[model samples]
Target chain A: DAGVTQSPTHLIKTRGQQVTLRCSPKSGHDTVSWYQQALGQGPQFIFQYYEEEERQRGNFPDRFSGHQFPNYSSELNVNALLLGDSALYLCASSFGLAGVVYTDTQYFGPGTRLTVL
Target chain B: AQRVTQPEKLLSVFKGAPVELKCNYSYSGSPELFWYVQYSRQRLQLLLRHISRESIKGFTADLNKGETSFHLKKPFAQEEDSAMYYCALSPSGTYKYIFGTGTRLKVLA
Candidate 1:
């Protein structure tokens, strides 16, 4: 079975430009979350989408936004990208509504490498 | 606010040596701790969770409430065990996870 999939394995953008990264969650999954991992650091949660609505968000600024489509696929958009925006954009998916299982594991994708110049 | 911390950015040990990766967390309420690992060229994946209290791939982690730590340990490290390990936390009844900076493990032959 296919796991979470992300589009445009890599992306390039410049300051003041906007970029959108796509993700297709694993089959039978309903929740999708986006994370940003800078070099030599762990991923920091960007936000989470469930039921076509954003459920929770991290400490990111308004420039970072996301949408969850009816098919459970999602997209992360970064506006006015800065050089620090260059990092690995990771997408993870889990199976449930407000999934609270202690064993709940988020399956991740290969991630899209975003480079901001 | 919930946060996770991995003090060591890099750790190297000889093959067959014991391995211990430190992780500490800060949360007021009950928290779910997890260890996630990413091997070379592989996507990040879950190694184990504190709730399971199960050993995976000969690795285990115990959540110490008093110390607010969930450290990953292995009795004997193998070359394949070398990877980037992250400690993540989710507050009780929440789905969002806060990950630590991560510890890169290298097992020398």
Candidate 2:
């Protein structure tokens, strides 16, 4: 089955520029979460979206926001990006509580690498 | 504050050697723990979860609530096992996962 999919695979933007990354939830999954992975570190939770509404968010600033669509696709937007924002953006999907999610397992897509100049 | 910690940044071992990657977590409530791995050019994937109590790819982890640690162990390392491993925790009453600083494993031939 086609797993979670994210695009574009790589992006480059200058400081203060805004960027949006997209992700398609795995087939039959509803919840989508975003994470930021810096060089040599594990992925850090950014936020999670369920039923088109943001359900939980991490310690990131207001500049980091996300949206989920009826189709279960998600978009991560970063405003006023800083050079430190350069990192791999990973998107994960999971079946909601009503579905048979395999206990807390999150399927991740090949992340999109964002490079801020 | 709840958190996960992996003390090792990198670990290298020869093939057929026993391997262990340590993970420790701090949480007020009972937590669910997991190990995820990412190979070169591959997407991150689940290796094993403490709740399963099942070994995956010859690897197993036991959750020690008393010690507050979950260490991944494999009897014999394989070159294919080389990858980045992360320890994650799910706080009680929430789905948000707290990940530790990952430990990269290099199974040398």
> What local distance difference test score does each model get?
0.92, 0.93
Candidate 2 lDDT over residue span A1-117, tens digit each: 789999999999999999999999999999999999999888999998888988878989999999999999999999999999999999999988743323457999999999999
Candidate 2 local distance difference test against the native: 0.93
lDDT of 1 by residue, B1-109 (tens): 5789899999999999999999999999999899999999999999999988999999999999999999999999999999999999988876689999999999999
Task: Write model 2 residue lDDT over B2-99, tens digit each, in one string.
Answer: 89999999999999999999999999788889999999988899999988899999999999989999999999999999999999998866768899
Model 1 quality (TM-score): 0.96
lDDT of 1 by residue, A36-91 (tens): 99998889999988889888888899999999999999999999999999999999
DockQ of each: 0.67, 0.61
Interface RMSD of 1: 2.0
lDDT of 2 at B44: 94
Among all candidates shown, the one with the greatest DockQ:
1
The lDDT leader among the candidates is 2
Error of 2 at B15 (Å): 1.1
For residue B74, give model 1's deviation from the true position in Å: 0.8
- DockQ (C-alpha) of model 1? 0.67
